[model samples]
Target: MMTDAGEQLEVQLDDCPPGRETFNDPLQEDASGPDSHLSSALRELEEPLLLLADVALAPPCGRAVFYSCPEAERVERSLQSVQLQLHFLLSKADDLHDCLLGGQGHVEREALAAAISSLLYTCQPYFNHLESTARSTMAQYTHVPADMCSTLLDFSQQLCDKLEQLVLTYASYGLLSLNEAEPDSASHFCVGQTQLGQLKLTIFRYCQPTPYLSRANTQLYKRMRWNVERVRDQQQTEEEDGDDEEETFTDYYFLCYEDIPNPHAEANEDSEGVSDGSVVRMWSIGQWVQANPDPSTEDIWDWILCEVPQGGYNRLLFLGHDEPSSRSATDYLQQLLLSCCTD
Candidate 1:
């Protein structure tokens, strides 16, 4: 479980060893001292920023091949921009510290809060882009080591979590205003369209044991509906009579519509005009079977019957939850594929 940022910060502050004081004691120290408690508070604020800078600069945990991708270049430039902003902010922090120490001009708390909030707001999209790029890259590599992919994914998630914690900490101290920050545009775009659904489906497909089909010849189904029902007791009895109390059977129904290309179409030519109409398919899970020949016990889920239309192929999909029923599938899938390329 994750610890609360405020509590974690307090613990770090309290755990300092004897004769190794870092930040001034806000509560015990005299308010009139040369280094006032306010200076300590400023130092406390600077700690998280410095930590974030280090995390941003740390190399990603997988093969460098991901960096060679075009999307990585864009992310690299964004990281550089973030680093520049952090440099400016750190310098501002020093200036604030010096001014407080000398009893000079007062720095407005609200202004400082706004500056931090604005910096966080600007840096958010870059991190978000990095995360999406990493996930998509991982999805594309079938031969890549599983551990490497997992490491990269975890690193991206950790960086985002740290960024969120920093924002929350600043907000708690009234050094940042969460309400005034704008919503993430990428999130808005994903939520407003079916692109997120397509991405999830893509990830799920790639993670399956079967080799992935060519996405170029594939067409996504936009207006799909699913229904789930428990299989009858008689059917279960006939299939298998087991002592396991949790043993149960379920049936899944999918209403699908997909485009299939004409086989006779000329190679290297667009076959948009020769494509067939949509096809619906129903799929079901088969009985459990031993997943391996080893002596150890293991089982895997397998589809029983995958029925395609008479003239077209079927494509199984994992739809996003709470997606609008009226959105165009073709447009959404196209945009999703384009995003993978551009990222």
Candidate 2:
């Protein structure tokens, strides 16, 4: 996954500027003695850092270990990734107790509890997809006793519900439910064969862009953020500059504009069976960088790439194959349209 450019970047990080390390804050020296408390503070931090590092980099074990499952390597990878992601999060939890004993450990309880609860609440889409993929694996090749998948899911959801209540007392940045239709939103689109009656516009359900989409059907995901949707703070701020905060927050940047009508819709693009989204998509990503946030043709990019500079596009999309997967994608582009002509 690490590209040549990425590997080069990694190598460059180890070669810091020649004189960078000699720099230090004069105020810090003044506050402490000649040696400064820096030596002691660094010593204290080293133990905790190593403790966490050990918990993280140690070999996998228990349920966290990857199963030597049957074929369908793609499916296995997906399942393993989810498990590993959770395992890493749990390792951090375990290290907390080891690094900070008793009284200090207990103090973190409220924050951890709230975080876990919030993650579950905000990650319904992830759970739903995970469960479905898990079930596919279970039914196709194996089995779980008593349909425990549903049982576990229900239990987890309920636990999260209880945790959600605890979050009410705190100032929460509740996630935007972008998949759901807004009252005045005019943007809408469909998936898999743009049909007069066939429609599916739900995207942004996943917290971030998903990987390994090739395992399933032909799918697509695109995001477009311009001078888009401006969401306001639900709870009015009590700060003296609350009015400014409210005014500043009122502008919305609609992240993904779904279902750009097929450029040749008259030619029946969806009749071939694929989604048609409108937002401008990346011709290629990870290898390119655009500094400007605004869409403008007149820029330095034109000379560098010898192509007319188009606009800024940082959104990620998983444009799946021409065929359908065992499961399908429901998500992408906007502005004047997605084309190589711009970028």
Candidate 3:
């Protein structure tokens, strides 16, 4: 037993197709008593009651739906549903304002704003998605009233502000934890990029600590570059003369480090120019083996342990080139030295 306006409002609120029940009767009442009869009547009157309140409350029972949702995911889903309902309601109102009232689509502005604000507040966990959704939906309306458009734009801006604040909070906490973990590690780590001909080369340098030995500090360097070169020759004349060659490319990796200066060089003056302290100590950790001239068909790099030159051996350099993998460069270097000693 619904009025014409009630039926119209119900039809507008029903986003589902024809013959589908939009609401479920959760409280089944018995006709045995007066209280039961009253409860059943109230249940039947719910839709009409919401329709009557829609004009004043805007999104009829959206607040109740939002607050009833317990979890974050459920709250977000409910908010989305409410937003869709509001959008449909606004569209219907706009049609009525243009066709029946013969006026600007201004009546639904308050309702639309209220729905947007409720969604923004309720779906805090999905703020990022909310901003995108609002922007996309707002873009779809080419003839929306000025007031409604302004409201939507304002809500979108608010969402952006909230998201930016959250990102700053996360970044601050991450930086604080990083500082606490290693205060001075940033000073030792360095990265640079340079152009080697047409190719780009990246250089990484860092200080590696040797805790067990007195000569405990060394500088580690890694260079990475890509190379394109000739891999094959089709003709015997081209192969011998290096004229016509097939080209191929591959990534090149080089690992090397600064060698610790000879500590006993200061004590022994006879050590070759040792007291001068002007000599540079550099050690290459990997060797290049030209198994094939063609770059595409061969493994050109080999890793090996270099023997320390004779007569300068204060202690044989034990470089750990093997250990459990880690993201830490210093720890990896120590593990490499430990591996060399064990082997």
Model 2 scores a TM of 0.19
Which ranges of candidate 2 are over 4 A from the true structure? 1-71, 92-101, 105-117, 122-125, 132-343
Report the lDDT tens digits of candidate 1 across residue range 1-343.
Answer: 0123334433433343322134332111111112332233223333332232223332455644333455445444544443443344334334433433354223544434333323332223333333333333333433333343344344434433344444455446554443311231111011111113223221100001111112223343322221122324555665676533433332222223333444554554336633232222322111112222322423322222312111223333333333322123322343444564479
Q: CA shift at 106, candidate 3, in angstroms?
A: 48
Per-residue lDDT tens digits of candidate 2, residues 247-305? 32211122332233445434333666654553234221111133333335556665576
Residue pair clashes in candidate 1? none
CA RMSD of all predictions = 24.7, 22.3, 28.5
Off by over 4 Å in 3: 1-245, 249-255, 260-264, 267-280, 283-287, 290-343
Q: Pick the candidate with the highest lDDT.
A: 1
Q: Local distance difference test, per candidate?
A: 0.32, 0.29, 0.30
Pitting candidate 1 against candidate 2, the one with the higher TM-score is: 1
The best-first sequence of candidates by lDDT reads: 1, 3, 2
Q: Candidate 3, after superposition: displacement of residue 78 in Å?
A: 49
Residue 50, candidate 1: alpha-carbon lDDT: 29
Off by over 4 Å in 1: 1-108, 141-144, 177-343
Cα lDDT tens digits for candidate 3, 167-259: 233224331111212421211111212222223322222223222112323254322111212233358647667767544333333244444
lDDT of 3 at 155: 40
